[model samples]
Target chain A: MALLEVKGLSINFGGLHAVDDFSIKIEKGELYGLIGPNGAGKTTFFNLITGVYKPTSGTILLDGKDITGKNTIQINKAGIARTFQNIRLFKELSVLDNVKAGLHNRYKYSTAEGIFRLPRFFKTEKAMDEEALRLLKVFDLDDEASVKASNLPYGKQRKLEIARALATKPKLLLLDEPAAGMNPHETAELMETIRFVRDNFDMTILLIEHDMSLVSVVCEKLSVLNFGQLLCEGETSTVLSNPEVITAYLGE
Target chain B: MKTKSKLIKPYTKKSFITYALLIAVFTIVQLILNFGKMSFMMQSLLVPLCVYSILAVSLNLTVGILGELSLGQAGFMCIGAYSGALFSSLMKEAIPEAMVRFPIAILLGGLCAALFGVLIGIPVLRLRGDYLAIVTLAFGEIIKNICASLYLGKDAEGFHLSIKSAADMNMAPDGKMIINGALGLNGTPKDSNFTVAFIILLITVIIAYNFVYSRTGRAVMSIRDNRIAAESVGLNITKYKLITFGLTAFLAGVAGVIYSHNFSTLQASKFDYNMSILILVFVVLGGIGSIRGSVIAAVVLTLIPELLRETIGNYRMLFYAVILIAMMLVTSNSKLKGRITAYTNKLKGLIKKEKKGEIK
Candidate 1:
């Protein structure tokens, strides 16, 4: 059974159909890539699935449960987490805290317990701190744990954003151009980290990437989009070779 | 290491020391005033000190942590002040003991304000930045005007609302006045004292501190830091925002209750937009998201005007303007900020060195 299945998902922002009739199915632990030219509605598709913009029509099923128009937090709890193309790190927060924010849904301590400094607050807090540090270490950001997120270098900030997303422990991870602002060296390292996470965490990943090199290396299958509609989807080599996909996406 | 985990702020040794020093000064000053070391003018400012402290700290949670502007905080306070004063007065003949009645009134005031928070926060949270500020400011004006026109009285015919003044409030011959229109609520018992206000302030600080370090605090801060990022992480933005705004309103209400009970007569005019703006100045000058800074700012700023009135005399407004501009210049100056940070770090290093020496 597919881990995620979207059927006829559509959204129109005012007069423009930003994302139209988007549908895809991915098995658990699959590595999928979303590739399209500029203004091709790739990010909009991610937005619709994550409930940032309410879809005008369609159903999104995660593990066979329908999750249409749920609030971002609820959709997150339902096992979908994402990163931004612009690298939205909590600028004022400590590096550790940036990741710890994602673990917010995992705690069971009540607000009263938190305010009162109950043992449960300490127990869970320590666990979260350890977990956040562990994830930061995976991205080699443990050394910068105490630094303000905005003070980190650009590549490290991108790594921190991904680390923060992973702290939520989602079954499905979405990346919106994670390699957009990196040098070749940095992009290579990020691709290695992405591959490592997909395999080690045993989770599904769908990334909208403009970097064809990173996509070709990491993705097992690819979906091509053009003007809010899917043009073609197949194994990476096959889709890359399709004349229609070439004209619509890569040919640019 | 143990000390780091013992408190909400793990590495803020300087702020911790500053907070301790200010709290000690507050207690010492109160004791000295009680001993009649200060004039009546100085002594009377104590209650206002605590009230403004509560107001500043709670408002910081909204402006600093929640990243939403609110100017109707004083409106919530008005609701609390009237509700609390009314509850205490009605319970007076029955409860008798000031101790029993006052606590209940404070809680009721908080709950009442929280109720208003729910009613106002839902629509207001949808608006952001400057627009949100304008709406809250309008709410403050609207609430004050409505209270000015409202009249409440209790008698054998139960409670009644009258806009034609309290004297004409149609009630039994033995009716008791709750609020007398523009004249405001009168004859409420003065059960609030400096000690009670101080205790409430401490509790407010503790709760705010704990909240800033908790998981919920992280979620709330994330919303302020980046709304899109927070939502995409699966945080219900509205739910967290409502909870934060509600809690801040509740604290402001408690402060209002304390202020109302500290005096016998209360007026809606006291909680105007100017008052809201004054408290915001305390928050911004203290350093946004710095709980300890808010407390110190509240106390120091409240004391400044009174202190200046005696020292600077008729040139008070001019002095205040100069001082405010100077502060802004120094705080906003990058070189000055760097120097201040470097100096504080040096002080911290000295303290750590002292601790090591003691261990040896």
Candidate 2:
């Protein structure tokens, strides 16, 4: 059985069909890529999957549990997490705090305990801090954890977003444009980090990348979208070399 | 090499020593003022300063931490003041004459206000930013209008009437509600003292500090920073925002109770839009997300008008507006960015030095 299954998923923004008849199934621990030309509903597909946008019609089943239209927080609690296309770090917060925010759902301290600064509050806070630091260290960002997230360089900021998502302890991680602005060297590093995170966390990853090279290098499987419809899906080399995908890119 | 010194220089033990010295100065000033046979006017000014400090800090919880602007602080305060006044007045007949009922009444007022906070927060907190501010402002106006229509005092014949029944009666020859409309609620016991006000202010600061430093506080700040990111990470924006709004309203209500009891008089007009704006001015002038700044702004703004009263007289309001606008502009401008950077750098330095000392 697939770890995630999207059956006949469609999303309409008023009169515009943003994503139409999208369906995909991913087995456990698979690294998959969703790619397309601009205005092809690639990001929209990610949004729908992450519960940012509900589908107009269809079912989204994670491990056979229907999670369609669940709020983002609920979806996150159900072990699916996604980074944004644009880095959305809490700019004014310390890097550690930004990662700690991802663990908010798992906190054991009650509001009363927090307000009173009880022993439980301290213990939970310490645990959260340790977890956040551990995630930062994995991303090689532990040294910068005390710094404000906004003050970090662009590449580190992107890495921080992934670290924050990882802090949620997601079973399935979605990366949106993880290499959008990175130099080739940085892109190479990020490709390795993605694999490291997936293997270390024992999770599956689905990433949206405009860098076809990075996608080709990291993703074992690929799905191509065109104008809100699935154009093709198969192994990365076969899907990228498909006539339809080549036509969609060349035409655009 | 120079970079390390630059990073480590500012946050030395001297930084803490300066804070302690500042605290000492404040205590000394407070002592000098309290010891002297201060005029009633001076006492009134100090009371408002203390009360407004609590109001500003509490309001910051919603405005700064939760990233929602609220303009109904005065409304909550009115609720607290009225509740406190009513509770104390009613208890006068039952409680021992020597026992202090003001503290209990203030607490009850805070509780009542907090209850109102929950009610108001449920619907209003669903809205964001400017929408939340507008709704809260409308709520404040509605509360004032309700209070204006409420009749809670004795009639000419010394007979007490329910506010609703009193409203149904024709206006007396003097155009008064026969129950004090616009004239204000009178005969409330003046039980708010400086000690009680300061104690409440201290508690408010402590609670706010604890909240801003907690996991939930971080979540609220995270929401403030990026609601989408926070939501994506499983943080419930609505729940945290409501909690913040309710908590702020409760504290505002406590301040209101203190204000009402101290004056021994209450007027619907006192809790109007202007009062809410005044509280906002305190929060904004202090610096958003800075509790100490809010408290200082509250005290300074409260005292500034009074200090200018003799020189500016009725024109004092114009001067106050000018000062507030100047402060806002200055704080928001790039000029203060240097100071803020300096402060943060100093703090970072101090933390590093402390860690190094502990390592040794």
Which candidate tops DockQ? 1
Write down the DockQ of candidate 1.
0.55
State the lDDT of candidate 2 residue by residue for B35-79, as single tens digits: 986667877776677789999999999888887889999999988
Q: What local lDDT score does residue B2 receive in model 1, on the 0 to 100 scale?
A: 38
Candidate 1 Cα misplacement greater than 4 A, ranges: A10-22, A56-58, A247-252, B1-19, B156-158, B335-360
Model 1 sits at a Cα RMSD from the real structure of: 3.2
Cα lDDT tens digits, model 1, B1-360, are 332243235634644674577679778987897788988887688888989999999999999999898998899888889889989888889999999999999999999999888789999999999999999899878888887778998888799888777666777768877888888989889998888888898889888878877888888999899988988776778888998899899999999899999889998889899899988988988888888788888887888778899988989878887877777777778999899999999999999999999999
| Whole-model lDDT, model 2 | 0.83
Q: Which residue pairs in model 2 clash with each other?
A: none
Q: How many angstroms is residue A40 displaced in model 2 relative to the true structure, after the best TM-score fit?
A: 1.3
Write the residue-wise lDDT of candidate 1 on A100-124 in tens digits. Answer: 8888887657777878889999899
Clashes of 2: 0
Q: Comparing to the true complex, what docking class would candidate 1 get?
A: medium
Q: What would the TM-score be for candidate 1 when compared with the true structure?
A: 0.91
Which residue pairs in candidate 1 collide? A73-B234, A73-B235
Chain B TM-scores across candidates: 0.90, 0.81
